[model samples]
Target: MNPSSTLSLLRGICAAALLATATSGGPAAAESWPTVPDELFAALGLERDVPANVLYDAVAARFHDQDQGYGKGKFADLWEPIAISRYFDPGLYEGRDNLDFEVQAGECASCHESVTPGWVHSWDNSVHADLDAIRALPEDDSRAYKKEHLAEVEANLRSMGLLAEGQPLATVGCADCHLGVNVKAGNHKTDLRLPDAAACGQCHVRQFSERESERDTITWPQDQWPAGRPSHALSLQANYETAIWAGMTQREVAEGCTMCHTTQATCNQCHTRHEFSAAQARKPEVCSNCHNGVDHNEFENYMLSRHGIIYQANGDKWDWDKPLSEAFASAGYNAPTCQTCHMGLHGQPTHNLVQKVRWGFAPMRSIADNLDHPFFAERRELWVATCSQCHSPSFANAWLDSMDKGTEQGLRVVEQGNAELKAMYDEGILIGQVTNRPAPPKPDEDAPGGFFGLFWTEGNNPTAIEYRNAQMWEQQLMRQFKGLAHANPGGFTYTHGWSELIGSVAIIRDEATRLREFRELQAKVRELENAADR
Candidate 1:
């Protein structure tokens, strides 16, 4: 049988086994049964006094069904996660729901110290394992805002039966996660490696939820398609192709854009797996995968800024693993990284990147339409507060506002360039063509009239010549948005982006007009020759 078919058969067998066990009994504590409504047991056709072990087995069938759903979520990485979740929920854990796993954490550490020394060392120093330094800060400390998020994480875990609600929450230790009650010591048969982002979501819920959220592909990225511009397949949740190559949805960019999108999740996109070090996560390089190069060059733009220069100069001496409680205090570090602006020690340590920007790269629509709106206002407020940590509010706000206006100015320039392209397209000069390649087969060759639209629309021509025309159109516009957004005014702004944008539009129009006139002259010659022959 085929691989997918074989995997499907195996899953069917597992479900059958779980269902057989579930029909017999489930794991339910007897003393706790009295608190439950008798109607619940009646619905299942079970006795009210069913033990927790019996109740657990009876629910295994449903658990299996639920586990199967993970293999088919929107995320591209689900196969391993579903299998790992089965290990987490053989439904065998039984004991008090102790939230703090300090003693258990030590036991977990004792054995792994020899094998994974580096990972063990990283985990020991990780914020997940300890936050004592943060707790030491005074109650009024601003950076301690992460405490509420941590508490919220513990609460979410407890509600999901992963942690105990009664005890005080601490930094999530290894034991809190590997919480299997009957898991044996030196259990050589069991797999301890559960690195699924879904598993982590029970605790770290917010960021996990945000991984495949809509904001990921909100506007546009480098659209040099058919000429091959990079795109976020997972984030955009679409199949895309380009001129030079194809794109993959997998974490790795294999085979140079041959476009093989896979079932990989963006969960470990930032946090990574295993040791899950906050120190590594805090680095600006983490944001580079999705936020760099071509049109979206904020990460590169930042490198050109004074902040990048400072980090390059004196960052090695600075501590990256500073506690949340002290992060806002700004230890004697000379420069800031991308994290300092977006996820910085501002009062809020959030995963929402949009909260840090007022103008962003594409404020064309937002500035004109939603400038004074609440969402835009809220974002500016957050940015102002974050910037105020370093620069004075007046200085920061004025600087940020000037950028917003710059973006607005950039949009006006784009509108001008757009008008030039629209005129060419409307005048039977720059024709509509599919940007995708291996371009879809051309519509009826003898078709008479032209279609109005050019952007991924039906009934449009798909010629190599047209594809080149579209590429010219797509790339020139990238400068206006990409340059203004990155704050890199030299190359991306006037030099390459906006200044060249106007020039490119004119060149395309002139070429398109030349092509149209040549075609007309050829048709006229054909007409004269036919009349002479008649």
Candidate 2:
């Protein structure tokens, strides 16, 4: 049957009810349908009654398939959010409601097993589905190391006073993570929410604390950049505050920025859903999704390097389920994965990837020798210790020195390009500088449009020379430092780093010369025309 045509039938039912009341000599009611009551709307902070006209229009539109005369009552008022906030969920911003998982836990699996067979199937295979399986394994199990790790996690939970003494461990079912362990939180159908980082932290205390430590890092200059900034702790906020990300009208493109930044939202980005296997996240392939690109190609650099070559050849043979700390011996790994190198600190692996970060991919100015700074020197020493695991102390130190020198040279070249552009900008001779060039996106104070201008453009504002300089600083410089840091010699030299920097430098110089000559020529033409007229 046609959905829209049914709206007339729905209206007829309401009209008949109204007519019956009138003929019986009873007073007519203001509302004909029991949509969302005014009390419910008031509780949601919408401060308005559901209008009969809105109900009639919603029935005609057929917004939802099971249109119960008024079509998804709460969702019908799409405009209500504009007056309050961007997000429309009623209980979303409110503090989490406590749950009674022990009593209500089996309810979710029993229903979803039939409703969403796939969800149930995946959950059935996961360790979260049954902790008894882990407990049943023998003490001398081949993967006995993992059993030990689980014991530690269980003990940690007990220490937090969350896991009560003698309370037998429960399976980490849907409610355990999505809702809490014990209280009156509603049913799964209505109370389900997107679990935040804090929810995961509740159970996986060790991993959660390590990831959250990014907030307390003392790496960057505190006066300039925020302490946790350029780290995963602040990734989502950084995306939201980015000028181009906010200014762009294309919401799809903006959402792409959040794709990688979702790490701040959920553990599933790396761990993934259903299985959420540690072995899968241990592989370098997981990091490749976000880490490969023009700006920061750490994945590409690693793949091309000697370390990546070894992993690609023999990674499958190795046991990835083993802890990252034991990748070399227990896992039979000859070469380091991205996790082994970055997350591996002092022979132990951690979730805080930024703990030992120095010269964080792209530093704007010419930090000639970061070692001079005591904080950076300390981090370099930690890296030296990490590298010394495979190579001699002398060899590790020498390679670091080379990377530092290469980065210093790259920074100087970028600084020279910036100087040239700034000179043009100061002289007020840059193309479209005074006439057509509009300001760049907000929060970025680059008057000459260097870094922030690269994301967006207006007219000829960041003219040819300006664009060349911006690319040199943003893209080429990033490749140079990151390529060196990742131990990809060819990456830093010819592939995408040093060679690209040199090419950009030449282009900037050539563009600057041409622009100056063109400006001089225009002045000469104007002078010649004035003389002829006289």
| The best candidate in terms of TM-score | 2
| C-alpha lDDT of all candidate models, in order | 0.46, 0.64
Error of 2 at 165 (Å): 2.3
Q: How displaced is residue 385 in candidate 2, in Å?
A: 1.0
Q: Judge candidate 2 against the unseen true structure and give its global Cα lDDT, from 0 to 1.
A: 0.64
- Candidate 2 residue lDDT tens string, 1-534: 586557645644654454344334222121422222333223223333333223222222321122221111222222111212112222123332463223365587787778888977877877777777776765334344555445544544554455665454657777767666443345544455556555665555446545655645644753345566576655655555565666555556556666786565567778877777788899999998889887888899999888889889999899876667668855788888888888876677777777677777575453454456767778888888888778888998999899888888888888887877787788787887788887765544556636666667787767877777877878888888888887888778898777887888787777778778998999999999999999
lDDT of 1 by residue, 343-397 (tens): 5424645444443344443345544556576646766777677677767889777
